[model samples]
Target: MSQWMTLFQKEVLEMWRNFKWIWVPLTFILLGVSEPLTSYYLPQIMKSVGGLPEGAIFEIPKPTAGAVLASGLSQYSTIGALVIVLGTMGIIAGERKSGVAAMILVKPVSYFSFITSKWAGSLLLVWISLFIGYISTWYYTGQLFDWVPIGEFFQSFVLYGLWLTVILTVTVFFSAALLSPGMAGFISLALALIISILSGALSNLLEWSPSQLTSYAGVLLTGGELPSDTMPAILIALLLIVILLWLSVFLFKKKELAA
Candidate 1:
């Protein structure tokens, strides 16, 4: 218990020293604020930058607040996910390369403690950064368009956040298992993309897949009628998170640390 607490504190301090606590939230806030602002001003923006031939008229339809929020989430799905991937890709691999892993392991510390501490720290960062960003998005969306229902907004956030955590967990697992941070990040991103794309293409056929979590989140945000049943996807996603974290611990325990 003492070692786990100590390692958790150390992981947090490392994040603070590295300035991740500052930049990661800032990045999310920027994305959140920018998405709504751009969506609201898109028509004016297009007109200002127009090279339309011969007095062409382009009428842009204003999007609802929920649509704006969904668009913001779409941005996070791509750019925000990439940022998280890069930020965390090195969590364990970098430690191994620097001999920090070996030093820590040489103590009486358990591998589970070491890996879970890192996971907890990374999860903290991910949740905080994403919450701040989404709150900013929700606020800006309300200001620019109609306010989304508070209950629906909260539901959307929880669902999307689960999907995001799954991605982060995959990255952490790969970071523990792989030697190269780039490879870890790449594989994690690839896996996330594949899941999303496949779920999208297959739709009802793949409704049970974890990718549907993001889709469910979008539906909640957009006030769209959800599928009659989606509990399976939610359950599957939660199961995957548990399994991946377990796999990460298992791999970390089996792998030898470099000195």
Candidate 2:
């Protein structure tokens, strides 16, 4: 426990030194605020820059608040996820390359403690960034559009956060197991993309996929009936995260000790 705490502190300090603590949440916050702000004033923005010919009449319908929030979340699903993957792709790989992981392992520390500390640090960043972004989006969406029900808002937020957690866990696993950060990032992102595509393609057959979390989030935001299978999907995702974390620790220990 003490070793884990010390390693966790080192991870936190590393993040601060890298300015991840500043820029990551800021990126998310900007995404959240910009999405709704742009959506609310899109017509005006289009008129200003669209370069319409004389007296062109454009009839654009305003979207509901739910639609606006959903749009923002879609951005989160793509661009936001991409940014996070790229940022964290090197967490374990870079340390190994720099001999940091070897030095840490040479101490009286368990591989579980080292990996868990890294996971905790990464999760802290992910959660903080998402929370700031989501809250900002919710507030702006309520002001520009109608208010999303608080119950639904939090439900969707938590669900979407799980999707992100899954992404981070996969990244960590690859980072620890792979030699190249670029390859790790590519593989992790590819897997995530495949999962998302498969979830949509096989929705009827695969009711317990982690990708369903994003769909369930959209449903919550849009006031649709909550899918009955949501709990099963959540359980499956949590199990997958645990499995990945354990794999990362095991692989890191074996590979690092052999070095």
Candidate 3:
């Protein structure tokens, strides 16, 4: 336990040193604030751009707060997810490349503790950053649009966070399994895209998949009928996270032995 804590602290400090704490939150905050501001200002923005013919009566309906928040989640689904994958792609792979993993493993540290500490640290940063960004978006949303119910807002946050967790776990697993950080990130991103595409194309078959979390989140925000498969999707996402973490540890040890 002590060893895990120490390693976790090291990971946090490393993130701090690398400015993950700064930029990740800042990026999310920007994305969050932009969604509400843009939605509110779309009419004026369109008029300024003058894309329409002269005297064209272009107007946009005011978006509800729930819709605004749901759109913000979509922004996170693309740019935010990319940021997370790029930021964390090197977590384990970089350590191994720089000989840090070898040094740490040569000590009494168990592989479980080492890998779990890294995973926990990375997740802590991600969740905190997402919370900060999402809260900023929520605040602006209430100001520029109708207030989203607090209960539904929080539920959406947790569901979207779960989606991100599955994506991040895939990145971590690849980082552990591969020597090249670029390859790890590429494969992770590709896998995420594949999962998303398949989930959408076969929604009936994949109702329990993690990718459904985003849609479920949108439903929560919009106050729509909750999907009956929501709990199953959540459970499957959690299960995928666990399975990936286990694979990370196993692959990390095997790679180290091969080295």
User: Residues 139-209, candidate 1, lDDT per residue (tens digit)?
Assistant: 99999887888887777777777888889999999999998989999999999999899989999799888
Q: Candidate 1 clashing pairs? A: none
Off by over 4 Å in 2: 51-56
Query: Among these predicted structures, which one has the highest lDDT?
Result: 3
lDDT winner between candidates 1 and 3: 3
Cα lDDT over the full model 1:
0.87
Q: lDDT per residue, candidate 2, 1-259, as tens digits?
A: 7888999999999999999999999999999999899988888888888778888987679888887887788777887788778988999998899888888788788999989899999999998899899889989999988888887778888888899999999999999999899999999999999999998999998888988898888877776567999999999999999999999999998998787
- The weakest ten consecutive residues by lDDT in model 2 span 217-226
In model 3, the clashing pairs are none
TM-score of each: 0.95, 0.96, 0.98
Question: Which portions of model 1 miss their true places by more than 4 Å?
Answer: 53-55, 224-226, 257-259
Tens digit of lDDT per residue, candidate 3, span 83-150?
99999899999989999999999999999999989989989988999999999899999998878888
Off by over 4 Å in 3: none
Could you tell which candidate, 2 or 3, scores higher by lDDT?
3
Among these predictions, the greatest TM-score belongs to 3
Cα error, residue 24 of model 1, in Å, equals 0.8
